[model samples]
Target chain A: MLVIEDLQVELAGKTLLKDIDLEIRPGETHILFGPNGSGKTSLLMTIMGYPQYIVKKGKITFKGVDITHAPINERAALGIGMSYQRPPTINGLKTRQMVDICAKTKVDTEGMARSLNFGDFLDRDVNAGFSGGEIKRSELLQLKAQDPDLMLFDEPESGVDIENMALIGTTIAQILQKNPPRAEKGKPFVQQQKERTKMGLIITHTGYILDYVPADKGQVLYGGVIACAGNPREIFQCIGQMGYEECVKCTI
Target chain B: MYDLEDLKEKARQALDKKASFGGDLDLNTFDRSFVPHKYLAEEEICAIPQEEQKRLIMSGLDVTGHGRGGTYFQKDTSVIHCQSKEEGIQVIPVTEALKNHDWVKDYFWKLVPVDQDKYTASALLELHDGYVIRALPGSKSVYPIQACLYLDKENLQQNVHNLIIAEEGSELHIITGCATSPHVKRGVHVGISEFFVKKGAKLSFTMIHNWAEEMDVRPRSVARVEEGGIFINNYICMKPVRSIQMYPTTYLVGDNATAMFYSIIVGTPGSYLDIGGRIYLKNRGSRAEIIQRSISNGAHIINRGHLIGEAPEIKAHLECKGLLLKGGIIDSIPQLEGHVEGVDMSHEAAVGKVAQEEINYLMSRGLSEDQATSTIVRGFLSIDIKGLPEALKAEIDRAIDTSNKDSM
Candidate 1:
């Protein structure tokens, strides 16, 4: 579980996110929709405690502990992980080595690679010459290795093709420990007992990931603030009918 | 052909000319005649501490000195022991080889001409002792021939002229190590190595140097590859040295021949190093690759590389990279020359401090800041050397591991 109250963030002396509030309970997933330069990534980076994301006035609590000014690495150790939209390329560090470092406990990396279909890239430089789909798969693979309780996905479906989108969607669902929508029909009774303990806050613009990852709530971020909160499906339908400007007007 | 007297006179005359780009050490200020010619008896060899002696030997040489193919141990300027088991293979002292074998004169000092610089000239004129390895035509051996050159006394100068010849269709590997005792306060080492790879032969040479902070080292080397031959050179210097200046050159004279140069240099406090590699693709279909990696910590390092494409259809590449930890200076230069229209030559060089993002990424994975910094530094120093035997690779890996530990 995570909570944020009145989080006003500034970058380079310019206010990016103003008076923002967000909360995610255990076993819950929240979908955040915003246009370009609408402070979607700013919110996630702020919560992750990036030094550049200056929090003018706010408090962030994770598992009943105030971690407002925690270091970036400290937040990562405290069960918080993120998949960046564009990760830096490390020249000499191998992909498998990075995965081993991320997995603090013993992990079957070969098995994980097989599941993610990235076995050939295990020995290559991290994200050096990867395609769009390959980079996404690598990010997800590292996140899986981290095995954090709170997952933050930044545009997981931004540049993925339709074929790889299905795989990314299903993996995101599994990471959240949620039953797939396709498996919702004719599910076994024993399968219903699967524990759902992980929480997620995913940022999306196209809303394509909603088809794969089920969200309990949706919020519209406009003008550096949360404009509305409602059901994900209903909010997506409303945004499709009316542009983001109309949605902001209706919410206000 | 010049006789021995003529060559000696030529080298003596060139001893006054300094190298174009010199290091911090000035050989003129020191007395080169203070060196003593002391023989290392069996008991005296064992008198040196085991730890210090072990540091002088290559990583994979754990067996006794007289193990497999051959082993040569030299202290100061005298060859203490030399042995060989295999037929058609000769490992003898250079002075003895020059006197006994009439054919040895044809290959000695032929590849690495002594009149190039004063350091090389000094090594040729004032040479003490070194090894001469010869593999007869069509002979093949899997075991590596090992040699250890060490300085044990103060104010000593060990100038050696080593020659290695691989006849046509032969394959050989040479592993040499150089070190000095901690008590050697003022010393100078000038080593000259010349390698000749005949047609269709393969030769791999790996040298590891661990010297004290009071030593000044100057090594000059040259290799000539004939038709359809391959040459690989791996050079590493991990410990602190007062100054070192070396730039080994390789010439590919036959078609379908290839040459590779791999070097890793670590500069500690109060050290100055100027190391580089030069390769010439002189024949059609000849290829060359030069890779240099350097890490500077409170020291100064100058890394240089040059590739010359002289014939059509020749390919060459050069790469130089440097990592700065604390206060240090590193100058990396990679030059490319294409004389023929169809030849391809390119080079790349980069110098920068370690990225904060990389350290933070590692720290996020449960490693502390120090651990993260060490990990990145180690990765930066670990280069991928292709086409080496598994055993040789393992040996190089162990030496690299030792270097990493000592660097920090």
Candidate 2:
């Protein structure tokens, strides 16, 4: 489980987010919806322990451990990982090698890359010249290799073309354990649900990923706070019918 | 043929003249006296002292000669071992070549001027032993020929002149390492090398330097490529040295000829390294590229590159990148000149520390801060050299790996 209470984040000496509270139990994926500059990404970055996102007064607990001040690598080691929207290019480090680093052991990088249609990019420098969809796939490929217990996806479908949307969405779904285990076919639904231990928090703008990933809950961030919380599909319908102004009214 | 007396006089005139760049070293402070070692057979080379062999191996000279096409081992002023295992390849000491081979006179001082600088003059005046590795016409080397210039005498100035030639339609790969014995605290090395790539021929020469902290090195080298030929020159220096300054130049003299120069430099504290490359495109369709990567760990380094395009339809590029890990100075100078309207030349130079964002990106992949920095540094040093043999590429990677360990 992951929990954030009374979160007030400041960046570069400016308050970006404040008075935020959230929780995500195991076997659940939450969709984050908000207008631009509503501090959605800031909330996720604060949760990941970026250090630059100073938590003025808050507590972040992950898997029952207080991790409000943990470093990025420690957070990663404790089964928390994030797929960046615009990761920096690391020259001379092959994607193949990056996968191995994420795995922390010898892995079938080629096999994993093939599954994501990224086998051709295994030898290239990490995100050196990747296209939008390619970068998304590369990030997802790493996340799959990491196999973190709590996964964070920051706009996974932003720059993807229609051709790759399904691929990226399905891969994200599989990583979140939303897809049923193929080997456990014909198993009881309750048993399958009991075995789904991975938790996910995805930030989206278009909500196109909902076609593939069946997010259980959703929240609207308005004025640096969670304005409302409800079923992800119902929230999407309500936000589509009425602009984010409705959320602002609800917050007021 | 050139007059030997005239060359000697030119060298004498420049003997006391200071180089245009780099720190000046007084020649009178070091010994140039001849130091001789007995010729070592193949088996004897393998049976040498283990400690000394370890030093040589770090510089990429394997005493076992397992996969080498030839071996040339010069210790101090003596040619201790010289042999060629493959057919149509000649590994001869420069002195012996001058004494016996009449054709050697044609190439002795042909490419590099004897009066270029004080270091070149030193190599010409007090000449020690160097190698002349040549590939015959239409011949191809099965494995890279290995050469070593080992300095064992303390405070001695080891002067050497080397010539490498690839005849028409032939291919050659050479790996040469220069190192000092473990006990030598201080020394000076002045080396002159000239290369020739004949028509339709290819030559790749990789030089690795491993020297002690008190060593000062100066190497003068020049190359000429003919029509339809290719030349690849690589230089790697990772260990600490008091001072090293060298700027090798290549000329594309014939149509469609290509030349590429790649170098990696690492400077530790108390080290001063000034290194670069220059390529001149003189004919139509000639192409040239000079790429350099340097890191300074509290040492002062100067990286320079110059590309000149003189003819129509010529293309050239120069890139110099420097990373400052510890407190040190990195001066990157890249120059490009296009004299003709149809010539195309470009240059890019950057000097800075590793991007924190890049480090953070790696850290997010679960690596610690130290691991992230070293990974980026190693990647920054790794360059994909075109046409390099797999074995030679592996050798370069191994050198970078060992140095990465030391630097971290």
Pick the DockQ winner: 2
lDDT of candidate 1 over A1-252, digit per residue (tens): 799999899999999998888899888899988788999998988877777889999889998888889887788889888877877677777889889988988889988987988899999888888887788888889999998888888898878898888889989899888755344567664455344778899998889889988788999898799988888877888888897778767765
Q: Could you report the DockQ of all the candidates, in the order they appear? A: 0.47, 0.88
For candidate 1, the per-residue lDDT at A58 reads 83
Put down candidate 2 lDDT per residue, A1-252, tens digits, no spaces.
999999999999999988888899999999999989999988888888898999999899999999999988998999999998999988899998999999977778999999999999999999998998899999999999999999999999989999889989999999898984565677888888788899999999999989899898999988788888888887887788888878546533
Evaluate residue A138 in candidate 2 and report its C-alpha lDDT on the 0 to 100 scale: 97
Q: Which residue runs of candidate 2 sit more than 4 Å off their true CA positions?
A: A180-186, A248-252
Each candidate's iRMS in angstroms? 1.8, 0.7
Worst 10 residues of 1 chain A by lDDT: A187-196
Taking the tens digit of each residue's C-alpha lDDT, what string does model 1 give over B377-404? 8778777887677777778878888888
What TM-score against the true chain A does chain A of each candidate get? 0.93, 0.96
The DockQ assigned to candidate 1 is: 0.47
Cα RMSD, model 1: 3.2
**Could you give me the TM-score of model 1 versus the true structure?**
0.92
lDDT of each: 0.83, 0.92
